[model samples]
Target: MTVNSISFPHPVLGNGDDISDGSISPEISFQISDESIRVDVTSLQTGHPDFDRMIEAGEAVWHLRVQCPRTYMREDFFESGSNKTFHLEGVDFEGLVTIEVSLVTTTTLATYRPQGLHEDYGEEKFRLGRGEVVGIGPRYQFLIDKIYDPLKAPVSSIIRIEEGEDSEGPFTVALDTDLIMIHLSKSDYKEYAGITDRVPTVIHSALVLPVLADAIRQIEDYAESTLWAARLKYLLDIRDIDTEKPLQAAQEILFSPIARTFREVNMRLDKGDD
Candidate 1:
């Protein structure tokens, strides 16, 4: 008898948000025959301690059964790289997918063992083990040159595309003297091949200023003066000084009272003034 579809009695385990304490369990089903059993399993939360324990304990199991075919299997049912059989009604039994089962467990603990104390002070940690059911699908790569190459014609002085080691991929784009790099996924590179238009204004805007004023203020507060200066220089070099509104906002930050004070102090020192 050939197996049909396997029904999972419960939802697959998932990685709960509470990393400190969380657990999940999913029911797995398998289709089987008298001679062979095909089993597959997956867990949404693969890295948690609880999951690890479940695997180690062998608590997860798949129930199997064999199904009798209503008619003789057809040749078309066995497609390339597939195990499904064709039914008389033209339904593909290649739907009989195979899955491998495995168990995983993990543990975490935080403790302090003082030299004078006989007992250690500690916290117990637990996490779930996550499982993945592997499968195959399409493969592709991003060709950065196809898209960024044309961008140079419009902003060659500020943006340039460079071809790296072939292994690095089709091509890569560099903005100004800074090392800001963007990689295109293979699918996106292929989609870009059909388009002949230049980059959109919205994209250009986003590329120039991905963050807001508040974010800049936070950066200035948290980063060192040298680092902030270098970041600002990079932005100014790639951005159109006159047309980009974000540049004006950044300029205000550089000339702000706090920044002005720092510059004044440096200027005085350069003038040899005590």
Candidate 2:
């Protein structure tokens, strides 16, 4: 989850109505090269009397939390100074990486009166235990899209058609990789490929729909298995697609490909076209 979405019990620097000076901003930059990611916190301004005093007296410290939840990776770093570098293994990350920064108490606070806290916050009298987060900064998100060969891109990019073994089944979906591989019987593959150019929508309804339906199911159990799975999961989350009903989710993802297929067929027939 992003830092802004979290609800803190006490006043925070970046959130509403806290810190008189309004300057608890941290700037973070990520430099990714191959399998290494270098995180640099260039500037952090703790511009307030209480925060300054806490830092000077060693009562608080800066906490940086980095997470790549899709890959189930998380790392935390604490430092007294604002500027710091974190060397991370980038290969373990996929989809999205989140960075959360906070000002945490190093020692227990019997009574803390942060300036400029709104009166709604019960006159700002509060007590916090050691390591409690007194202030938070903005959340940062970076998308780590996995590189793929152009031919191996997902159905969102391309679908690979190959002749199937045994020449029995109508079609089978090999949806494990980013590329959706549709294996059809030898004869069926030839005919299917020849006709696909004429009825693209119908081909999508007949083939792509099932692949996507299966993809939805795969994402539930194996979203982190491959780059495509993680990418699909990210799409589903961002589009608010409900994965409980795989067929419906697939239809939504493809914009009702089945319905559009029929519409295209009927239009062609009406115009006396193939």
Candidate 3:
């Protein structure tokens, strides 16, 4: 199977029939050859604020669905009558895909009822709503991520460490226990910071802090039983106390600065009290 060519529609002009007069038409085409598949999307329309407001205030949503070729079933792949699939020999199967295009237009209407004098036309609308705008950014990011890393594995799986310039084939090396320990230590600190930043201070102190404290106690017990005194000592030296204690100390350090800033702001506001 092969696609020969693709085309798109031209801009459409309206003579006061609808609000979308003189707006660009949305069109897209795809050409599939033996080597690659090429897609051409033209005149993709974007909506304005009014179109957004209308969508938000309306009940219906626009949906587009593309059907797959029937030959996809005979390509030694699974098939579903209700769903679409694409398969290529010696390549991974592609699933059903749909592309949506929207256009936005702004127009000024001439007032006929209010005499011949011209008045300021103030009509603002969004062809695409707020939700649509917010959704588009994430969708594009997802497409980029997929194109770059289709398998979607962790970074370690794809990266290769080499000795010198001429090294080629994948080389395996013994894991450095010390490096692993350091990485884990840094990861724990980042996780602690993130949780402290997001959780409410009151709840963190009353609930989360105690839970973390208990977990640290368990870790201390494990360290003692396993006779890993050196590792335990290294962990303790990093923070004069155990994990939870150091986390609490770091939180205190962060909180004090915030408190001081708040106090200064309040003092200034009090001096200008009204």
TM-score of each: 0.19, 0.59, 0.18
lDDT of 1 by residue, 182-229 (tens): 444465445444431332332333332333233344432322222222
User: In model 1, how large is the Cα lDDT of residue 29?
Assistant: 38
Model 2: per-residue Cα lDDT over 1-274, one tens digit each: 3346356777777676555456666877878766889889967657877887897789999889888767789999998886989898878877667788888999999888878776777665789999998878887766577463323433555357788985666787776665567789888888887888888778778888878788778774654345566566666676788899999998887778888988998999999996
Q: Residue by residue across 140-228, what tens digits does model 3's lDDT show?
A: 10010122222232112212222333223322322222111111234344444555434434333443333333434444334322222
lDDT of 1: 0.30
The whole-model C-alpha lDDT of candidate 3 against the native structure comes to 0.30
Q: List the residue pairs that clash in candidate 2.
A: none
How displaced is residue 242 in candidate 2, in Å?
21
Candidate 3, 43: how far from true, in Å? 2.6
User: Which whole-number lDDT from 0 to 100 does residue 22 have in model 2?
Assistant: 60
Q: In model 3, where do residues sit more than 4 Å from their true spots?
A: 1-20, 46-100, 103-274
Instruction: Return model 2's CA RMSD, one decimal.
Output: 6.8
Give the least accurate 10-residue stretch of model 1, judged by summed lDDT. Answer: 135-144
How do the candidates rank by lDDT, highest first? 2, 1, 3
**How many angstroms is residue 44 displaced in model 1 relative to the true structure, after the best TM-score fit?**
69
Query: Which segments of candidate 1 are over 4 A away from where they belong?
Result: 1-177, 193-196, 206-274
